[model samples]
Target: MALALALPAWASHPGQRELIAEVVRDTGQDPAALEALLDGAQKQPSILEAMARPAEAKPWSAYRPIFLTPQRIDEGVAFYRTHRALIEDTARRYGVDPAYLVAILGVETHYGRITGRYKVLDALVTLAFYYPPRAAYFRSELKTLLELPPDHLAGPLDALTGSYAGAQGWGQFMPSSIRDYAVDGDGDGRIDLKNSLPDILASVAHYFAGHGWVSGAPVAARAQPAADARAVPVADARPQWPLEQLQAWGYAPLVPLDPALPSSLQTLEGPHGPEYWFTFDNFYVITRYNKSPLYAMAVHQLAQAIAAGVGDAGP
Candidate 1:
């Protein structure tokens, strides 16, 4: 009865409500608390505004400046050194390679120094309740969150503690992904990604592995376009297209004799015409962390910068 009324706070979408109901039943959470959250969430305008400005919409030239600063590269290095053991162990365990993990951390939240200031409660609340375009998706995440394991006095809601988008902790696993992949790597029985270096490393490695990361392979390299490939339409400067598809368009191989591999052709507007690359499967693996080619590229470049012994790589 009361639970039926609370459904509106989640979303108008039928699927969203069902999932929420399932989680509430699964967790034994007071349906009333979810109602209260939805009641308060439906009133926040800031959350609505934030969703409209997906950072990926910016041009690659513009987005490039946001992350590829000399400072971020340096920080990526420092972070690598501090978490060396965990990173190495995770690489070995997941077969994902440590540099990729470090790069991902560097790009996602600047090594946790600035892991988005938004409270997870607020962002999820805003998106799930108000933003009809994506409410269904966010609401499902809320349900997944409520069903996370190790229920306690705190209940399953303790899963992720920050960001309204439901992406929290060091690597910012979305609620669903967090529940599915998070592991307590240090044997402490707590899968605390925010502060546990071991857990964060392992969780991230798990995530990449789940997304199909290839170990011991080049992510991408600077390349020129094939004469015939030059006219293919570039799609938002991302690494989504496969290599063969890109080659047909105009992107040439950067490494002369590396054989054919699946790749994406990115055309970021450079200072001159455009910066292009033939991205690989590993590059696609990075995008699973954040579904933006530019973001993954920034992280990859920063990781490379750190690995190359020419940058800061932070804590």
Candidate 2:
């Protein structure tokens, strides 16, 4: 839908341009201009490196403390109170829970404090150019960025100031997603993800709905695994191991699990030796973004904390 128009002249990447031109053949627009935009994205270096950082495969224990802080929880409550109207209204409209939205904001940008210091264009370009592992995917995102009309957002800077991975705004969405699902929630005729709480809140809700967020359903469960279970990657490595299969392997979930769903078996470092959980389908869905179980648990736990009314007036 984004490539249905002309894009402004841009400093294009030569090789990437040609490839994008072929890809944009039937999109009803100027292929040369689209090529130019993709070309500009092909020359960034840092973006590629960001995609392959050491943090990507870090364990859940290592990832948990990075977020899920007392400070973050306190900040989440304050953010909730300050933007209660937009958060609540967006939740009501989208059927996505409000605490999860608030928790996502808190985890992603600290309610917009540190969304990332990289220029989004440079980041996307770098990844698409040099990050061979996910190069094709990021390259498509760069295409989405160039395919959309610029307007006052015509300057690359509007979409460029964010994560080294090129995710923009409080919820850290890719530029393409921003273009597709972003709503003008504040009636300003523009969806300013960086500064508009309404837009950010609405965007968060929309993303969850797009991802099949089932409101009031459990995101994850906490349980201890038996000593005998050893992780052997199987067919559905991303999903949790089914409780039946896991029990056969001498691992039992403290709670009942849906047999139809696949699961991921994770053993976490508990206070003593280890603790474990069979991550559910929804948990795997959450990890699709970051792929770290700890990050998902932190978000799930933080959301629960907020919903439980943490402190005086839940703050």
Candidate 3:
């Protein structure tokens, strides 16, 4: 009788074999190869730790300074200058603001200076099997990563690196976002988000366009609440009320805006005191990228700063 072969360490992991079998059935990828790939993926505890304390959890006053700074704005201007033609052309192609494209890159990775430091495989596997809170979501993303064609990824599965949440490239796109929105802007027959600027910029713009980004539209406006302002509870950043209704509730935009426009009122703890903001449809669109209002605000403010710095020079 032939001796039974010993299963790999990863295969012994709970649910590991089931996941591999599902991938094999869905994608027709070789099971042996999938097992080998899983064998190479080491569970990362730090990824879980980072997830529990995300920067988005910070208060608005604390979070505001992380991405918005003089240095980041200056660097964004320089980055835009360096890739003016490609950025402008891509923005035009996708109907997105060029400054926003630059700002996303700046806030996500400091203009590609710091994409991430974790192996993509480890990050996904750890989150998928170990983190119970978002395990299903991570499991789906892990499956997507495994199913991706060779060209969609910048490198081999074992070699790819990204954020703790498994987001890749300068824009910090997850695997599903890569599948849905990533583009080969360079026309090189491959989408390399990490090393290719055309791919990176175009992918970000495509995501915004897919999420209904309105070009040349107001994102947010500071609101002056009446001394006897009616207290309004903001649940999420989605625009659910008309601007006129918000005014009746005592939150009025400091700038002129159409009363018919749909908007949401957001109150944040600012440096000095509570800050009121009337967020618009475009602002709601930005929240689609990251559910946190603070994140959207940071990106909006950063984009405005970069736009001011790049001024008449933008295309």
Candidate 4:
């Protein structure tokens, strides 16, 4: 015989109380204050639905066209031109390509134009409690948000909005990312990634530099696979082999590169057939910003197009 479990009698979720207690103990915030704040945060079912089907879930064929559009490229170029001095300065300081930094913002929040409309508290609460897939991680971010200083936030705590996953501001930095990597680029004594372009640019550059952005290093190159070689495409972005070994395993770059450079053979399904590319350490660094290979590729391709002056024209 099968038995069903009975629901608890509390009006609020049992976990809410547990979470409040955990936060109070870990952060030393008053339990009453935490509970009062949490009482205002509503559970969002739509956020859970959105989390289930992220854009990264799409195939490379579908994902590429979404980000590498003519309109976005044109806008990215305009943004780069408008902030040329800041971009160049930040790039010089961080040892990252200016085009790449612009592309990160362009891909992330569209150069501060579309930084999401969901309340950060609502999104973080919904994901922290309701979403079991990444509840632990989101719960940690919730703690970080609670610990954020008022100076770093622009307006009221509840007024801030960002991505469904709780990333905020122009660069869509997570709570922990903001705490670790955010900088006061404008010299106003506060880091605001939402409205402050300097802060956003500096913060993005700092993030890339922290993750090992090899200045002037090649990101990726088209590789001609050997006819008889077995395909061993990498699913993750971490470079696992040196260039010479990848070449021996049937992946040869279209352009010449140092044999000692670290690389990995990456493959994606193109409209025509299986496409191969030799991704370098710099390409892997791009993936640190976003885990998917498609995301990194889109950013790389967009940066390349911008560097080549492809504005309002298709890459």
- Candidate maximizing lDDT: 3
Error of 2 at 293 (Å): 2.4
Count clashing residue pairs in model 2.
Answer: 11
lDDT of 2 by residue, 1-315 (tens): 344324322343364655566557735677766545443443455555556665636665666777777888888888888778778889879877778888888778888999887767677767776677887888788767766555313135534678888888888888677777777777777777887778788888887777767666556655555567556564432664565676677666576666555666666664455666666655665665556666677777788777665332211
Instruction: Give a tens-digit lDDT track for model 1, residues 1-315.
Output: 886685544445454456556768777776766555444433356667766787788877788778878888778777777877778888889987787787777777778876665656557766766678987888777666655664210123423355546687768788787777887778787787787878888888998888887788777777687656556564543446556666566556655635456556666766577887777777777876777888877878777788775343321
| Per-model TM against the reference | 0.82, 0.79, 0.95, 0.92
Candidate 4 residue-wise lDDT, 1-315, digit = tens? 122123212217777788777777777888887766766776778899999999999888888898899988889888888888898899899998889988998899887888998889888989888888899999889888888887777666778899888889989999899888898999999889898889999999999999999788889888898997666857697888888988888777887889998888778787788789888888998898888998999999989878767342221
Output the worst ten-in-a-row residue range by lDDT, candidate 4.
1-10
Candidate 2: lDDT of 260? 50
Q: In lDDT terms, how accurate is model 2? A: 0.68
lDDT of 1: 0.69
Each model's lDDT: 0.69, 0.68, 0.89, 0.84
The total of clashing pairs for model 1 equals 21
lDDT rank order: 3, 4, 1, 2
Better of 3 and 4 by TM-score: 3
lDDT of 3 at 256: 87
RMSD of 1: 4.7
Clashing pairs in 4: none
